[model samples]
Target: MSRFLPLTIRFADGGSMVVSSIADAKKALNGVWKDKEAPDYLAATRLVDDAVAGTCRPAVAFAAFKKAAAQQGLLKPADPSPALTMLDDLWSRKGKGPPG
Candidate 1:
């Protein structure tokens, strides 16, 4: 079985989704990474590294991708976000509702 990393995403307007593995998270981020700088593959790699190493929260991985893209001047800075909001929210909401 594949080892999974739990991750969450919250939109600027308050919508959110949770992904259970790095693979899924990559797919989700790719949807946004295409319009930015540096190949989406590269950004995805860096984001995975940052997430696994804990230098970046799994959710902030997206922000890091945005930052890297902006540094290359291929895209503008993404909006500010709460650090690791996805993971944080997921953990916080655990066991409080009906099973999925």
Candidate 2:
């Protein structure tokens, strides 16, 4: 079974959508890039995949992906998704002194 969460992704156009899995996030990001070509598409996808797979920090990976997309003119300036923010926060606290 797939783990589903109420995640919200905000778009560059001031719009947003809710998605569950990494696949859904990829699909949404791809859909946004449909009209335009993203620079280093594979890299962007890989970053997202790695983030979702817990292989890398989500915020860092997502920031890199967004930068690539924007450089390619595929996306505009926007804030990271709420889910990404939360994941990043949690990841940052992973190796803290101890659980409170």
Model 1, span 1-100: residue lDDT tens: 5344334554333444555555555555545433444565476567767786777676666555444434443342344466667656776789454335
| TM-score of decoy 2 | 0.43
Q: Highest lDDT, which number? A: 2
Q: How does residue 51 of candidate 2 score in lDDT?
A: 80
TM-score of 1: 0.29
lDDT values of the candidates?
0.53, 0.60
Candidate 2 C-alpha lDDT tens digits along 1-100: 5345334555556566665555665665765443345455666678778988889776655566555555645453456788988877887788553245
TM-score of each: 0.29, 0.43
Q: Candidate 2: where are CA atoms >4 Å away?
A: 1-25, 32-39, 77-100
Worst 10-residue lDDT window, candidate 2: 1-10
Candidate 1, lDDT over the whole model: 0.53
Q: What's the lDDT of the predicted structure labeled candidate 2?
A: 0.60
Clash pairs (backbone) in predicted model 1: none
